[model samples]
Target: MDLREESLYLAPLYSRFPLTIVRGEGVYVFDERGNRYLDFASGIAVNSLGYAHPKIVDAVTSQVKKLTHISNLYYTEPQIELAKRLVRLSGLDKVFFCNSGTEAVEAGLKFSRRWGKERGKYRFISTVNSFHGRTMGSLSVTGQRKYQEPFEPLVDGVTFIEFNDGAALEEELKKGDYCAVILEPIQGEGGINPARREFIETARYLCDKYDALLLFDEVQAGIGRTGTMFAFQHFGVKPDMVALAKGLGGGLPIGATIINNRVAETLHYGDHASTFGGNPLVTAVANVVLEEVESLLPHIRKVGDFLGNLLRERIAPLDDVLEIRGIGLMYGIDVKSNARNICERCIKEGLLVITCGKNTVRIVPPLIIGEQEIKEGVYILEKVLKEGSG
Candidate 1:
């Protein structure tokens, strides 16, 4: 179908770019007309290893041939392996897999509620400007009111605390009425804001003091995007629960809520479940993706750091650029100019980037991207900025 026809048929939920990406490899994606563009957003940080990695393709093909899927009622080797690897890597005791970041978050929410009910507590505290997911339950705790305005009277007992504000967090926790406190170590959709070190440490301390579970939603910043397998590792502040997705499945769709032993055991048999949650096909591919990335984690960390530094050096000096805040591969450039216009200019210059928050341009290239691609994209961005300024 033609572009216009396709647009007419689809919902207007997303403001799509003018170009249609037909194919991708490494850090480059090609339009339908074969115009190659350097991919800096990595499909919003979903493609961890870039497009068409040989290992991923091979695993998916082999798994498809062996077993596509079966009921979760029975055991599946791939699911078992993926769960084991995740638990091992995360130092978490149990794992429950689902289809997307939102589902993973929903699962975490359920666990938190159950963790509270089993102990007789039932409120949750989330930070302002935090973005969890779009589902009703996850959306309730999401810090942004714009998303919740349409759907009023969301899950009750959700209090909003200021992000990176230790004093406010301390005040809220002192109330001693919250069952869980969930926040992203690095807020993704609310702009690339990193949690203050003191705030994170304080959150941990307060959660302990109040017997509330501290949940980290690392869906966008997890699975090697932040140099470490998980962002919480960098802070040395382990959360009671973590919601993971995005890069976890490479190109495939997968999500998981990892929990500590003591906390995880709160859920009973029928507390929560999903048919495709632990299916063999998705898990098979996720297992391969995890193993491949785990083996190349050191390389990912090195390249991510190099890219972040390059961005800081190149864009941080611009008069219109306000700040560069992020770690490893997930960095955002706070621009004084229109971030949407800059994103369009980047697309025109053969580099694909996206905007986040109000005035920040987010950069999240695939972990396998090399220094050459990084330099090339940055060069394009710099040229665009110079011309845009003029």
Candidate 2:
């Protein structure tokens, strides 16, 4: 139960919550003391199945018993099937697998740069306060000064501009030198900011006009998080290339870069490779995740709307709660003060929550969570906001 070992052995990179969660099921996770807390964070949207779901467990168990991994030199059915499912879901042509979100972003950048190789185009444009990933290349496109300043001398030729600012984006695109325009359909880390429909439409237009690729970084907001297969579906817009992770593997480590024919046609053998990517275990579980997510989509849409309405009617009236904004289940409560303390205190009150941007409480529960859990999470959040306890 003691976190002494973790403190002694692990790197100090993560600012962890105090509880040592040992097990989870449905929408509740238990600490070492066996205290069950409602989990609204869903491992920051990674546990799409809400923990220990029979389908994911069965697929993984059967897969490990059969084969755990095989290199890219050979073919595997799990890999092929998952790729097919993702391609079919996003209307993308092919998929490249990797270990995490940042890797997928890196692969996307490479694919874009390669597609524009003959044209001598290598520049990228991303939005301010946007979060792609932490690796050097993805970090280069990330607009947060805090994350980029430390890792100076990143992959060059990336421009950071304002989110939902279409005219500025158009000005940059008019140069016709960018390889790709990478965007998060909904900026999750930057406080649940959804891209304006007009902005995205402008991006598609400019990318077409400039012969550049439009890439979507759906790392946090994809895979039914927004009550759809992808958030781009919400705006009825499509990106040529999409990078996905977080919820793709149902709690397993996996990342996928799905691209249409424009980018795929240019990627020759050995242009990019991942040793353990698309291995049997993770992909098999991911297949199950896709199946489950398909079934849960309608339920997600209905319940997420109910939950959003509940928050609007209840939490939005509070003096400290400024606004409730988001799509589907990926909502955030913009607090006037002390959002981080509210998250930590929510853990103490038998609930789990996390923060994004500066003062927004991110509420991305599992796609399978029902209405009752939403009320409970908000109840705890309201209590925390009232108390403002750290």
Candidate 3:
């Protein structure tokens, strides 16, 4: 099939792969020609349970028959239950749901602004090389010039600090002009960089001292992706707010901004709302997804260690491989050559991976992936790297 002809009517936004996926099962996706490929990308970290998961299918199918959506003015059982579960797990007071990760970031930004408005604080401190979202507010704090340059005059007063620079964060917070310090515990789009423990601790301390909110963007690294419920758990420091999405609904679209009581109390009724936020369909699936993730936390930790060791022993020795960085199931293999070319070659060899940053190949397989599957995927990666180098 000619992609140009097939995509003539669609928006030219994505540089798509050549193959058209028709179905997926377990950790593999089948293209239109019925060729199966190990899907390590997992829809860019959204398919936590892989495709055609029985529980997710049951929840989605059952909910569609019962109730798919209802107004926020009315309460739905699934939405309420999921909110309670997230609140309990997050140790946060309330959750504001939206359709995607960017919306979650937008809500987090608004909540911090409103909470700090009366206190004469409005600026936001984000890190350099971080990615929040594409919308105006989230884009302003994204810290990537490539994503923000086209959309100038964004929500002002967001300052970009170096990631993991504790002194810079403290120096800025000392000014007492910022409302929030937004960070991604593991920088996903910025090359799978994990935050140093001391950096997060400093952020927590300074936020409390300056009365600023510490917002964590866990969209890419949350939901058992990092072997923990949330990436910040590894450091033993909690944030004032957390933005979650990507894997929350197992495949369905959902985003949530979990806030503490202090921020929740500052906002009154009608201050913010979403038309289809936390609708019955997505929330019901999210309930199952959360439960399944909690159960697999132990497995994730075990396999995450296995994967790390396997990569270091196998792929790390390749001539083109430069560096390996990641924690849990998420990893980035920086290569001496173009990462995009490597990803394309992997796709051709019946393995699916994606590129992050400039020369890094990112691997974020399903949380349920087993040792055998991991070996299969890594074998293909090794073959691709050797062939490319040769």
Candidate 4:
């Protein structure tokens, strides 16, 4: 099949760009025409270590030589190791592995429901403009009305409150009947907005007051993307559970939901399961990815801070730049004009970028991206913005 023709067979779920990327390495991707472009989006925050990292490649190769997969019916060493690493890194007590961010979210939702059932409450509270995933359970908790409107008659009892509004969050929690309150510490798809310290602290206290589980959806902001392993650490507030994915496997698909011991006990045998979840191949890759991330976290943070500051200093003063909001490497620039035009211009300038909600440009390069790449990418971005305005 002509690869470009494959688009016709696929569902119209994504609004794809014109270029077709065939391969990637480090912070760069090459299209079918062999044009190189600096990858600033990092596959929407999934390629944590960037493309074709040696460690990730070796880990997957070695695991394939040993055992590619065995269903969750049996024990797997890689899965156990990965789970342990995630639990230790996240400060959570246990983990449930899955194949994607949405699956991890689904697992988290089920765990939250179970926690509430044991305590006799079933309501889940989430924030406005928050995104969980497209799956039914996750979709139900997501706050955006647009995503939920087409798939109405969704799972009920989910209350949507305004984010960064401490009083509103507390008032909703005061109802005292919620099973859990799920939120994205940094809303990724909702325009890359970070949570306020007061809001996070209030949510923690309210969950404790009413015995509700605090779930942080760090799928896009976790695994070194935000200069911290998880966004919750930045707030200094510990959540009971965290839904993670995107960067966990360094490129290979993987996701996980980490839960504390008290809340984890709610999930028992036969309560939930995924056939490909915790397979040896994916877990082995994840183990290496986690190790690499832990070892290089210092560099990631340093580079992220440098780039974030540079972007702020350079773009904040621009006439067309509305605002730049983010922490570390995850940033969103709200432009005065349409983001699509700016993104297209950047592509023409040999840079890969993605647009987020409204007029925002999402800048989420791989954690392993270096300073020079950041400088060059920003230079291209500056040129695009300047020329696009002209």
Candidate 5:
């Protein structure tokens, strides 16, 4: 069967680009027709190490030969090892693994509810423009009306405040009705806005005072994308819990909700479970991914600075550029025109980027992306922005 024709059988959930990527190799992907495109999108920030890293390839090959998968019913060495690594990296007590970022957010929400059950706190506070996940539980907390309006009467009691509004957060928390305050340290889909340090500090203090858990949804900004191992680290405040996915398993599928000892104690046996979560295959790959990311932190910082400088020097000066927002390898170019159109032009120019929010072009290159790739991607972006402005 022709792969292009077979794609029609799949659900039309995504407004996919008309590009058939057959394979990838180190910050670039090749189409079925052998056209190459520099990949700054990094599969929406999931490909931490870029495409076809030798170590990742070897790990997958070796693990597949030994064991591909087994249910969470029994002990698995890879799963246990990966949990340990995540716990260490996140500075959390325990971890609950799942299949994707949505699952991680779902689990974190449930854990928050469980923690507050005795206190009769079932409500949650989230911020505007934040995109949590598409799942019912995650969607309910997400503050975008366009996404939530269609799925009417969603899991209720989720209140939205302005992003980076400490006063608003405190006012709601002061009501003493919330189980948790969930936020993204750097809002990914909400135009790559980073939370203010004062804002997060306020949330931490208020959550402690109001007896609510502070949940940081680091799904899109974690795992070395922010130069730090986790985005929250940059703010100098630790969260009660963190939801991670995107870059955690490199290119593989995995998500983890990590909680501190206080939250972990609230969850008992059978309180939550996933049949395929923590399976050997993905966890094994995650272990390698984590180790590799840890080693690349310094490199990420270096290249992230380089990329940031390139953006400011090149793209920011363009007439259509509204603002440049982001940290580390994750940046967004807020333009005067449509972001999707800019991204399509970039794709045509043999560069791959994506959009966040309505007018922001999102650039989340691989952690392993280099100076040369940074220059190349920015060149395409600058060219596109200049043309659009003209």
Candidate 6:
């Protein structure tokens, strides 16, 4: 269907860009008019492998032909293997698979509540300006009131605290009513804010002291997007559970909540289930994504540094540039002006980008992205800012 026709039929939930992508390959996407643009956003960090890698294509196609899906009552090799790999990589004991990051967050919330049921502790603590998920349960814990106000009478019993405020966190956790403390290691939608080392350590310690679960929502920052395999690896602090999705299945719909033995043992049979949760097709693709990330992670670290350094060289001099903050491939340029304006201009200049936080343009390209693509993308961004600055 044509771009205009598709817009008419589809819901208006998204304020889509003027450009309409028809196909994607490598670090570039082609619009219906055959215009190619460097895709730095990577479908908002979903296509970490870039586009159509033969290995992923082959694995998914083969699995679809063999057995696309079977009920959870039966076993699938891909599902089991993928689960084992994630559990091993995460250092967690068990996993619950779902269809998206929001589902994963919901599952974690439920598990934490069940684990704390005996004490009647159902309160959750999340950081201010954090974006967990749009689902009812996940949204309740999300700190940003703008998204929650409209969806009010939410899950309830959620309290918001300042991000990186160790004192505030400790004060609340000490109250002894919190079942879990959830936060993103690197806040995605709240602007690329990374957690402080002290704050992370404090959360782990306090959770242990108060008998609360520390949950990391790695949906946007996991799967080797950070220099490490997971963002938490950088802090040397492990969480009781982690919510993962976006890059987990490499463009497929898959999410998982990896929990420790304590929480794992608490979750009995029938506590949670999903029809397409661990289906063969998606899990098979996730296995490939996991394998691809193993080799690509080092590349992401090197190239991510290259991208950040180049941005510092180019945009840091701009009058409107506020600051550049992030690590690995996840970076954001805090701007004095509107971030959407810069993103719109970048798209017209043959580059695609997105905005996060109040006024920052987010850059989370495919992990497979190389230095050349990053340079070209940044060059266009520089040109856009330079031209508009005067």
* Clash totals, every prediction: 0, 0, 0, 0, 0, 0
**Candidate 1: tens digits of C-alpha lDDT, residues 1-390:** 277876678887888778888899877899988889999998899998899888888888898899877877889999989989989999989999898999999998888888888567788889889999999999999999889999988989898988988788778877776788998999999999998888899899989997999999999999988888889998889899999988988878889999998786777898888888868888887887788788777887888888888887887887778889988889888888899999998998899999988788999999888888889998898888777776
Shift of residue 63 alpha carbon in model 3, Å: 0.5
RMSD of each: 1.2, 1.3, 0.8, 1.3, 1.3, 1.1
The best candidate by lDDT is 3
lDDT of each: 0.88, 0.90, 0.94, 0.88, 0.92, 0.91
lDDT of 1 at 345: 87
Candidate 6 lDDT tens digits, 174-200: 899999999899999999999999999
Off by over 4 Å in 3: none
TM per model? 0.97, 0.98, 0.99, 0.97, 0.98, 0.98
User: Model 4: per-residue lDDT, tens digit, 1-390?
Assistant: 275675778876777777889999888999998899999999999888889999888888898999987898889899999888888898889988888999999888888889888677889999899999998989999888899999999999899889888788778777877889999999999999999898899899988988899999999999888878888999999999998988887788888999999886777889888889888998898888888888888898899889988898777778889899988789999998889888888899999889887779999998888999999999899887877667
In candidate 6, the residue pairs with backbone N, CA or C atoms under 3 Å apart (3 or more residues apart, or in different chains) clash, namely none
lDDT of 3 at 215: 98
* Two-way TM-score contest, 4 vs 6, winner: 6
Prediction 3 global C-alpha lDDT:
0.94
Best-performing candidate as measured by TM-score: 3
Runs off by more than 4 Å, candidate 4: 1-4
User: Which stretch of 10 consecutive residues in model 1 shows the poorest summed lDDT?
Assistant: 1-10
Task: Write the residue-wise lDDT of candidate 3 on 1-390 in tens digits.
Answer: 667785678887788878899899989999989999999999999999999999999999999999998779898999999999999998989999999999999999999999999999999999999999998999999989999988887888988899999899989999999999999999999999999999999999999998999999999999999999999899999899999999998999999999999999999988889999999999999999999999999999999999999999999999999999999899999999888999999999999999987679999999999999999999999999999999
